[model samples]
Target: MDIDLNTLRASIDAEVNRREFERLPARDDDSLPAAGLIDSVAAFEPIDLEGYLPEPPEEHQHIEPELVAELLPEGRFYNWLKRPPFARHLQRPRIYSLLTRASRLPGGARLSNFIYIMARGIAYRIPALARLLEQSKQWRYLPGRLAGFEYQANQGLYAHALAVQRNERYLLDRLQRLEQRLREQQAQAARTAGAPAAEAASPPAAMPADLYVDFEAHFRGSREEIRQRLAANIPRFKAVAALFSEPVLDLGCGRGEWLQLLQESGIAAVGVDSNPSMVQCCLDAGLQASVGDGLAYLQGLPDHSLAGLTAFHVIEHVPLDVLVRLIDEARRVVRPGGIVLFETPNPENLIVGACNFYTDPTHRNPLPPALVAFLLEARGFIRVEIERRHPADPKLLLQGQDDGLVQPLNRLLFGPQDYAAIGHAP
Candidate 1:
């Protein structure tokens, strides 16, 4: 199919313009500058949205009334689990319930625990109450669910006590073993100063690159699904096609989805990944890929040797130090005018930042658009623009939001779930 890059770009821009802070002052607007990087600000820092107010209520529209307290956002609750006391608890419902009951024992099962268990079982297992609970979102907030504030608060204390007990046992075991090993090693080192005592100074072992591959299908999606997803961003790829006269290098090419898109479009590209399984899968698909650390591969390349580079959904897995290094390496290896793109989950979207981002335990942090733009500029990447992708359906966004709060609420709740930071090497 012939690509209309302009039209696709316009479609993407239109969605962004609609959902972003356009009505607010330019300083608070969502669109970022492309010619230079935005200023370095922490991704999690509070933005200056001080004066931006929700629009006036619409006179003609009315939303179905569910009591205010019944609306429990799933993503918000997942982030709450990241807190100190709550974080320590066993996330499993059955385990938490068992532990809670055991903790209350004087000599036998406590009445509160018995009641809670029996009630939960009867409510969920019986046809009548089970159906009622199935119908009501509020029931999910019951004990062990969201509404168990007091129960969960007590669970926090129980979790802390258990954690302390386990940690003490582990520490005692490790310390005794460590002391013995250290004394033996110290004696050996003293006896062999000239015999090379460098074992203790060796760098830590490499993390198993395939550590999270088992969860890839859940988080990264199937190859066909990923390709269909990329199909929505044809303009983004078209921009890539226009900029590169040579093969593009795809970093962390999980499942070779983008590589497949590029090759099918007759665009030349090579994929690199640390996961051996991913690399082999790419090869089996008849796409070019290599197994190695992405940063190390970039560092090994000759200066200004490539025409373009892309790292989709890769940066979030890297430490900030290595992320900067990757940017620097890209600047060094890709020739002038070569395009550099990094697509990540858009944390500005509350649901994505708070919920989906955590599904991939490999993700280090969500890079806000401003911080990424700033980093690219810091490494001399120019024309750093961001494009929001995969917005929620307009119909869904409009429902119950006939009030002027639609746009503001959409920006807060239903904005694009992903973004691509595009720039060119200077």
Candidate 2:
């Protein structure tokens, strides 16, 4: 690169200005010096305007690397002083710390202050340590500067949120009014056009068989696998099954696993589901099955008629208020001393609730085990028990450790993924 005479002069002036800044007297409160004042001229190393200066070759291009290293110069006096024996060490961290302490003391105070500033500037290069250093500087004003938002901004945000809510309500009200008006117009046209015309135009109320079956296939396991799992748990069902004179009623019986298990155990049972294909599959397998909404079926049954009522992984598909009503109906429809069992995905298992439970789009929300138990008791059902089911892998669970930490960790990581709320109707 070429060096211009004007640029060379400017660079020389900047070096002199930098030296003047270093000689400036220190302030009382430890503020920075006026070093930034020379920044304009500091941009030039040498005045290379005409490309007169040569650029160095790339690092690894030379065969004799040591010769290339020798080209860089170090002052003779400094090199002799920095050598071994007479030169043990020129600097250490402790020396800087002692210098900082001396800055607060009586004599040599100004020199110590300059050393302290230089040491801290070097320390700020490491990001992790630098953040802690920065926090120390901001300690007094942290509360006022939290998230850097002002009081005015918070108030404005609150007002904007309220306005958005009001606009949403207004739009909903207008939509409902428009729907009602459209319905009225349709009804008026039906009166003039005839009942047959209205019937022809009406849409189907039930979900298509192929679509419903496909949805079940996407979210559910095979019927054979479910039956095998249910068969393994037949001992638990038998205890409840033996207490009743009439057959059990299994509502929302997806693939008839419980129904098949009840038959194999010689316990009479009937199943009901909203899906026609599911009900047909159950009937084809010679199980007594019916197509109907679970809630409506429970309502239609005579009071205290069924021996036991069991619905697995079904309650979470309905609204909370509807679930509460279903519990009340279960207590009513079940005979005295009969079992009412409702199982659902447990919200207590962090993984089940936060992740796996949502794999099925039909699931509304996970039901807390305690909440279901409390609901059963509130609805005049006694001897209620919360039975956690389907625990995750044992290796994942923190176990066999005497420490208190492992127990909570075990409950969070390997606790039951699903739970059953069992109660006896009085």
Candidate 3:
């Protein structure tokens, strides 16, 4: 391998100039004193420049006159002692670079500054430490410098160790709790698994075939709550009334709130609810209502007989296939020019969608505005317009606070879930 002596000389000169030392002498060490160049020259020895400086093996080949002068020189003395070539000459510049880079030293300190600087420099510049030490060739000065660096670096190292220990303790505690829970769940699951098989072997409980068969049982308790809300909506039901001049069907109409409004507005309105309790309550209130399934009642209506239809918060609980069928039913009943004014809870309200939404065991899902609009439009309903009512309750502010950024971002990007769709059959 051939080493580029000219390039090696150029790099050595560059290193020396970086330390503000004089240019390389053309002659050898026989003439001048090599004072400041030792630190710079020694620093370059550890770097494997074989790829750059490939040369053949010979006694004269590896030896640079400048490097030789810097290393194995004859008699050179600085102050009170004689200086050997490779012994130790940590000139002021290397000392300054070490201390200033670590931001530890001030100007005009004693020569002992090199001791602290070397310790920290080694820690600060790890793999570079060996290279720098080889370049400085000042390893012969004090072996204690290595130990000092280990001590300095250990300060932060111990703090990290304590934090890791605390994290391990926390994880172990959580793991133990999880293991206990798994054991309990396994035992409980074994017991319940047996019970299900026993029940399956026994005579099965009779189930209601149609939803209307047991609808009254669920509504008996919530009858007053439904009736009160329905009664309150009596006057504000003008939206559906204004949509049609012909007959209208009100779906899931508990106690006929909109029917009363339609009657007062002088528009024909009919109420069909599956809950017998709710139907009786509507009759007691002197409003026209009947105990029957909404889908069946809507389907039974003569084609093109109705002018409008309105279903509020009722679509979400309806299955998707059932919903499409209901849309077909709505299309069948309403005349070509009539409108369907439908409302459902918006899924965009995070508290409602994520938490309160599931409280009603019967609710299938919250119907989003886009989904409702798309289904209605696809089923031959034209001129569909969506509107959002009922801002989320102030109680949901706590949940909404964390999801504030998320809610608006989704609304901007995907549109809202809880809204109303008013579409015509045109």
Model 2 agreement with the true structure over 1-426: per-residue lDDT tens digits: 445778667866777676756655667876666653435444434443345455654432332423322332233433453356423332333433343354454543455454566677678988887998988879967867864667778888999999999999899767754654464354446445653311100012245755766766665567776676567557766876777668899888766778988998999899988777777878988899997777667766777888898888888887776686577667767888788888888889998899988877667778888889998876667789998887877878665657688888788877888888889865
The Cα local distance difference test for each model comes to 0.68, 0.69, 0.60
Model 2 residue 389 lDDT score: 80
Model 2 C-alpha RMSD to native? 28.4
Each candidate's number of clashing pairs is: 3, 6, 11
lDDT of 1 by residue, 1-426 (tens): 344667666765665555443333365656755444433232223434333444444322332223111321223433353355654443444534443454354533344544566687768878988888777756555645745677787899999999999999899767754653464354346445643221111011243435555567766667677788777545655666687676789998877888888888777889888777778888999999987778667756776777788887888887786687677777778887778888899999998899988887667789999999998875667789998987765676745636786777888678898898988876
- Candidate 1 local Cα displacement, residue 207, angstroms: 9.4
Clash count (model 1, backbone only): 3
- Stretches of candidate 2 exceeding 4 Å from the true structure: 1-219, 395-407
| All candidates: CA RMSD (Å) | 41.3, 28.4, 23.8
- Candidate 3 deviation (Cα RMSD): 23.8
lDDT by residue (tens digit), candidate 3, 86-137: 3233233343244333333453233355466667556557887667767666
Predicted model with the maximum lDDT:
2
- Listed in order, each prediction's TM-score against the native is 0.49, 0.48, 0.42
lDDT of candidate 3 at residue 205, scale 0 to 100? 26
